[model samples]
Target: MTDQPTTASPAATSPAATPSPLAQLPGAVGAPTAEHYGDPVAEQRALAAGRALVDLSDRGVVTLTGPDRLRLLDSLTSQSLAGLAPGSSAETLLLDPNGRIEHAMHVVDDGETAWLIVEGAAAPAVAAWFDRMRFMMQVEVVDASAEWAVIGAMAPADAEPSIPAAAPNGHALVWRDPWAAVQSGGWQYAAEAAHPAADYPAVELIVERAFLAELAGLARAGGVRLAGSLAAQALRVAAWRPRFAAEVDEKSIPHETDWLRSAVHLAKGCYRGQETVAKVHNLGRPPRRLVMLHLDGSDAQLPPAGATVHAADADRAEVGRITSVARHHELGPIALAIVKRSLDVTVPLVVPVDGVDIAAAQEVIVPPEAGQSAAVPRIPRLGAKSR
Candidate 1:
């Protein structure tokens, strides 16, 4: 893997001059400042053990308020917003008329208002989409990225209390990822931001870029390891998380991305792309499916993203292409791929990465036939015979 320096402006200083927490990670092969994390496995373990906090401030937050909040969100996003309560969140997607995903978010309702947290670079575009579609709605959308800081914390089951309580003015949501239990929230420390808690433990802990450096050193001193982007990629694949650029594309539909089932609301009334979502849910089939690819061999290099995945015994006929790959010390090489839903899971596939032949075993994470339509193909079992 080559070192790719992060492209975004160093959260504060020059990327070339400032050493980042990402730089401190082991096996960091790239330019160190690139958008990707350096070591993912160590990061996963830190999250699983409840001792690590990852800076996700790069994520964008948009706030919607007023009486039209729920109504407006209901129309735009793919999830039902009617029943959301304080302290909870649901993953959602905003789709184009063709059902292609434009943005994905985690929506949280703080009882009186709603917050949409989306991928960092996508905030402005998503916000603009909402503004154009407002029409006659009585809603107000404001970009809250600057006023708040987003942080992700993973804690062990036994160390729940050790997890910091929600900041006085901040809202925290307990997130369940495949590797860990995460508690995430945003606090107001910028101007006009009133600290909600008078004596919160984490209030004094700065969440700035320099603080990230300190946290990195603290983690190392306390035996909390840092995982690079590669490890993080592998962990996401192992956990079956659908990444943005990998699993979703300009031609991808929300239903096809498997986000509709978890993020879309079939019961919500009219919205921009509602017609297409409803039509697909009631009558159409998703064109593609998301699956996990378990690579063969303990020492094999996971296939590169975009490598063609082919049936090993069928003259290397194409079945799918690898979207993400990682070398997990515990799980060996693993990948995430988008494939034709009708392909037989029993068929073994291979991805040629560099000069190495990486074996592929498909494991379905989302089934097309589960809810949307009968025409959708059923997910095949990769280990059905053994089970």
Candidate 2:
């Protein structure tokens, strides 16, 4: 393990940066923490085999307490949290009035507190927003990022029932992922019978701050394997998991990422972006859609994040940009991109990197016909006659 060199990435050292517990680990480097501790592919394989654990401690955790906590959150986000039973987990999205995703959180209530797990990059901003929205609500929002460390569970073998797949154990509050299928009140825009996300089994364990070191030591001592961010991210991208930090931009909407499959409750009373969500799903189409790019493996070079994507044809115009890219142990190099909805699905795509074009084959993650299931009622005027 290498010693952590300097402070952090340029982004974290900025004004509102909130550091994480994992930043001090050996070989740890980066803004909030290290990208990996040497071998990313091995780490990824370990995670997939359920023989390891990854430090998602870089993510932020916000705890909401108070009598009106559930009610307040239900009125603010895309999920129905008011009726959520203690020990249950659910995901929700915070969007601008224009339906652009601003924050996403994996929520779990421990009877006394509602733990909101948000991406590290968006934590401080989201925590601040929660403070501003506390007009008259009885909810108390606290940025507990420094108080808790997240332990990720993925690829737990099917034989091990005690691998902690969502069930809370002792002091750990495990938030089970609902991305496997449509929740009770949620909707799946993608019509694929076998959703790629269904194969993704991931969970997060929230532990007390003081235990971070002991956990790291345990991983290093081979008590358990230590996987890196790449392993977790590779599986997430392969599953077509729509992450806010990557897939979302200023114009991003829930429909674009098929996030309604788990994050948004269509029948929920109301939320900030409900209007736009309703309008688009019922009457219009989202400007962009998500896709999985299985990149060409012949070339050793891989496209970096934010790389511009163009259709393979000579006259094809710029369609979208790569949001997240990873080299999967099995898939080689892969990426997740949000492209213009009108881009032909059959046409091959290419990503430009260092003046070179990498061939890409698109696997439709979010289909163009997403949200057609809304089925808006057509009401005729009072003067109209029956056909």
Best model number under TM-score: 2
lDDT over C-alpha atoms for residue 160 of model 2? 40
Cand. 2 TM to true fold = 0.88
- Give the local distance difference test score of model 2: 0.78
Candidate 2 lDDT over 1-387, as tens digits, reads 221111223254431254444545666565354467678888788787777777777777888888788887898899989988877789999877777787889998877778899886566666667767767988888877777767787633243422343233333377878998898788777767888787778888877656767766765665666667777889899888988778887788999988988999988898898999988887888889999999997878888889899988877579999999899999889999999999888999988788888999999988877765666688999999998
Query: Once superposed on the true structure, which residue ranges of model 2 sit more than 4 Å away at CA?
Result: 1-31, 155-171, 376-387
lDDT of 1 by residue, 1-387 (tens): 211111232243332334455555544445433233454655666544445555454556667776777777776666667666675566667776666677777676656567776665566556666666667887788766555434554443334423343332365534322112112211111121231111111111113344455555665676444444454455456656566757776677765545543566666666557787767666666667777788887554555688888888848788777778776657777777888767776788888767777777777655545335436566778877653
Q: Which pairs clash (backbone N, Cα, C closer than 3 Å) in model 2? A: 9-31
TM-score of each model, paired residue for residue = 0.71, 0.88
Alpha carbon RMSD to native, model 1? 11.5
Model 1, runs deviating above 4 Å = 1-42, 135-138, 155-170, 173-231, 367-387
